[model samples]
Structures are given as structure tokens and as C-alpha cells.
Target: MPTLTAYPLFRERSLLYLADMGNSKLKTSDSATAPLQLAREVLMIEAREVQALAERLDENFVNAVELILQCRGRVVVTGIGKSGHIGHKIAATLASTGTPAFFMHPAEASHGDLGMITQGDVVIALSNSGEADELLAILPPLKRIGAPIISISGNRASTLSRAATVFLDAHVSQEACPLGLAPTASTTAALALGDALAVTLLEQRGFSKEDFALAHPGGSLGRRLLVHVEDVMRQGDAIPVIEASRSLKDGLLEMSRKGLGMTAVLDEHGRAAGIFTDGDLRRAFESGIDIHATLMRDVMHRQPQTITPEQLAVDAVALMEQYSISSLLVVDQQDNLVGALNMHDLLMAKVV
Candidate 1:
């Protein structure tokens, strides 16, 4: 008898067998390339499925969207298992994109949560097989409430699909899972279908980026999209202003008092002559100009950066960045100085 470890041929064969099993069970560096190819194939298959759904979109799809748009109540999406996860995401996407929607677990809905649905609401149910027992069990109660059902599933003949007022076929050719057991391609198809519905409804409703901002006021997009210069500018006494005949010392005093790092120098008629910023102060000091004797008109940078109060604050920030300047004088239609703002003002207002 020979020890298995001492036999070279046996050891080599065992190593090769282990490597083959590893490739089949876990995708490691040795099997990485094949999995990537499989992923591309799955994506292509899912994309085709989505395109098929898009092409088959007829008056029924139109009616579904119209139903949701006209409904005085929310859209309720429900599903079980992997579909439930997709339903949750779809519900969130719809809610954020101007559609009032929420996800209800079919199992939970049957267990007293069915009260969440009403006659005014539209229900979207997801079941790839269209035969989930819990989902099917809740269909009668939902239909009895007079809520229209939008079914997303592969099997059109299944109980849940047959119960729906409009069926959106989320059929896929194959699952990406090697064993064809997990919900991979099917979930992807369902998600894409959900996205299509959401985006279509969003466009039909004329959902603007501003509308999106209102839904997400705490995020950066809301700040960038909704904030106008008027909302962030320093108006009234907060503005640093001086007349043309004012001494440079007076301009500096206004800038210091307002703490905006600059002052707007107005002409005799109250229009802006120029702006004197801290940077301009440094230049004036280097030029040996006496702050007390020099008029601000003589030292100020004329035709300074100015923005309309109606301008978007994000655009104002772009102007500042492009000009490499920190402050802008805000003026109205008459060109009279209405306000002033700096990067600090934008920061304080959370518009930057």
C-alpha cells in the first residue's frame, strides 16, 4: 500500500479534479472570464425581453398608465419572494418620481393589510410564474375592492395573470443562475419592466426635474436644481454698498461691516460703477494708493460681476468659478443694486 500523498500521478489527478469542481461551484480568478461572458448573454436576453414588452405595449398599457394618472389614490405594488424585492424598488421609484405608490406584501395583505388598498387605488402585482399561492389568494379581495390590477408575470394563463385587468409579460428565456434555480434574468426583466412603467408614467405626467427636486429636497439635486440666487443673496442691509464719491476707506468699511469680503460701488444715479473686493484692496495697497484720499471710483474694478436675482444660484456659482471670483452683485431690471452675495452666502444657504 502507498500513501496517497506520496503518489505523484494521484496527487496531480486530484488537483485537476478539485480545480474543475471549483470552476463549477465558485467563480474564482481561474473561471472569471466565463462568468463575465455569461453575464453579457443574460443581459442581452433580458434586454430583448424588455424590448418585446415595449413592442407589445398597446392600448392596454396606455389604459394602465391613464388609470394610475387619473386615480385619486396611490398605486399599490405587491409581490412575493424575489418579486417582492423588485416591487419594493418599483414602488420607491414611482413614489420619488411624482407617483404616489407603495409596496404591500401579498402575504401581509391577506393577513389584515388588505385594508391598505381601496377603490381609488391601482394595484400592480409581480409573480414571474404568475402562480404564487399567496398572491393568487389576495386577488379576489383586491378585485372586490374595485382596484384595477396590473400584473407583471411570465405565465399569462396563471391565476394571478388571469385576474389582472392588464397583464405586462415579464417573460425571460433563461435564468443566469447556472442551476437555473435562482431568480436572476427573471428579476432583471421584471425590474426593467417596472422601470419602463415608472419612466413612461413620469414622462406622461410632465414630471420635471424641478418636480423631482421637490420630492428630494434634502439631497444635492434639490439644492442645485431649485435654489435661485434670490434665495441665497444678501439683500437690504446685508449688502455692502457705497456711492462713487465715497472714499476707498468707506468701501473697505462697508465690506468689513457686511463681512462679505466685498462692497458694490454705486454711480451717482444708483447704478453699479464697480466693485471693490478684498483682492482689489490688496492690489490698491500694492499700487501705493492712499485708501483715505482715493475715491472708490478710482480704485474699484469697474463693471464687476453681476447676476440677476432671477438667476439660478447654481448658475451663479458656475459664473463665479468661471471668472475665478468670490462675490457677485445682484441687480434688478433697472440695474439698480438689489443685493450682493459671495461663496459664503451660498454655503450658508446650502445652495453651493
Candidate 2:
């Protein structure tokens, strides 16, 4: 029998045959490095394409922003295939950042979805080749509807670009796909361009955090931005509070009953005078103080950390973390104790 390595053609064929088998242990240096090398190249290609796009940006990009800004209606983004996927994300980002926008499938536009477009609306169409048949077929109707088209395409000379009110060149030198057929780098460029437009519109509209929170009301971001201290603070009798003249025993009972891990000591005027917590109780115990005889005013911490009910719950978390305390007292404009909240309250509210 001849050794496999004795014949180069037989050895190459054997390796190729082994590669076809699903779990073959045969390995080659080139095969091992190819994936990593190709991945890096893809990233580099996409990055270069985006950088080129930035350089090629002219007055047209500015005009596109102005057009969207002036429109009284929503921004209708339409595309096909991968471009449609990117358009969906672009529309979402725009809507969340202050621009009222939605993705409209180009094929569906011909099936009566065209009515979604109006004279006041601005249309953003994405097509790398600028010749997506479905996209081009609806150009005339979009024109007749009086909606200005902003075309993002790789080929500026394509029909879509020629018919557009403003053309944005999203051309890339080459695709990240080794075969040059997949829409890798081009899709990345289009996505980046869409992001640039959405963010620019957001800045031009002076979109604030509150506006963003409104759009994302179901997420943690909404909780952090929209939830105020009053929303999570335990109010009315739920507040663990005792008069300063009350005994430590009374304060402990209030803390236990409210389950806030602490109790607010109120002054004669019913203001938040101090705070007493488990730590204070332990120290008081170590000091050999009489829990029944000692007043809250004598054992409580005076002028403890306080927060306004109108403030955000996230801010309350910050104050707690800063002071290394587990609870906070909510006060009103006149320093009247209104409510109380501990870490558990915030955690239960999912504000933390």
C-alpha cells in the first residue's frame, strides 16, 4: 500500500473528500484562518464604505434633512429585500427619536398601500441598484401623490435616482461577500446612512430624553426616565414614620410594619426631621441605650438624605447609592413628609 502523502493529487483529493464529511477531524491552516481573515476583511470593507459615504456627503444630504423637517406628515420609508429590512430599522429609529415615520413595503404600495402616502408626507426609498422593479413601479404614483422622494441608492444614474426629488449616494466600492453577490457592505452602508439621517433629524428637532421615553414606554428606559419618585414611593399610612418624641421601640415597630427597613422621624411641624434605620438600632444597642426610654430624636440621624416626589425614581437610586442608605423620605415643597421608598420598592417597580 502507498502512503497517502506520497501522491500530492491523492492527498488533496482526500482532504477535499474529508471536508465534505460533516464531522471530519481533518484540518488545514488555510481553512482555520480563512474565517477570521474574511470576517476582519468584511468589517474593514464596511467601515471604508461608510467612511467614503461620509466624504461624499454634499448639499443633497442637507436638503434631505430640510425636506423631512418641513414635511407636515410622516416619513414613509419603503424598500425591498435587505433594503426593506434596513428601512424597517431606519423607520423605527426615526419614530423613536422624534420623527414620525413608518416602513411601507414597496410591493404592498402597488396593492393599495400607496394610499398611505400623501402630499405632506416625505418618502424615503432604499435600493442599492436603484432598479428594484417594485420600487421603480411605484415612483410615478408617489410623484402624482405630490410626496417628494428621497432615494438612497448605489447607482446615481439609475432610474430611481433620476426620478427622486433628492438622491443620496450610498455607493460602496465592493461588497464584503467574497463572491461579490451578497448585499453585505452595501446594506451596512445604507443602514449607516439611515442612522445618520435619523440622528440628524433628531438633533434638528431638538428631541429630548422625555420624548424618547414616550416612544419606548414599555422598556427599562421608559421606567428610568418616566417613573417619578411619587409613582414608586409608598404614600399615606404606608410611610414608615414616627414623631421625633416617639421611643426607639415605636420607630422599630414602624419600620417593621412598613417593611421599608427604616423609619422617618418627624419634627413638631410634621417635617422630616431625621431617619432611623437597622444600622442605627444596632449602634444604639451597642451603646447600651434603652430602646423603650430613648426618643427617636436622640438616636435618629438628623437631616437625613431626602428627595422630592416629583424627581425621577432613578435619581432616588442615585441618592441611595451615594449615601449607602437603603431608603429615602419623599418630601413636598414645604418640607412636609409625603411618602417613603426603599431599595425594594424601586426593585419591585423595576425602576432599578
Steric overlap count per candidate: 0, 0
Q: Write the per-residue lDDT of candidate 2 for residues 1-352, one digit (tens) a residue.
A: 2355533433564677687677556544466665566577668878999999999899999999999999999999999999999999999999999999999999999999999889999999999999999999999999899999999999999999999999999998788765577899899999999999999999999999998999999999999999999998999989889999999888899989988789999999999999998899899999999989999999999988999999999999999999999899899999999999899999999998
What tens-digit string does per-residue lDDT give for candidate 1 at 208-227? Answer: 99999999989999998889
Worst 10 residues of 2 by lDDT: 1-10
Any runs in candidate 1 off by more than 4 Å, and if so which? Answer: 1-45
Deviation of model 2 at 50, angstroms: 0.5
Candidate 2 lDDT: 0.91
Each model's TM-score?
Answer: 0.87, 0.92
Clashing pairs in 1: none
- Cα-based lDDT at residue 226, candidate 1: 87
- For model 2, state the Cα shift of residue 22 in Å: 12
Q: What C-alpha lDDT values do all the predictions have? A: 0.86, 0.91
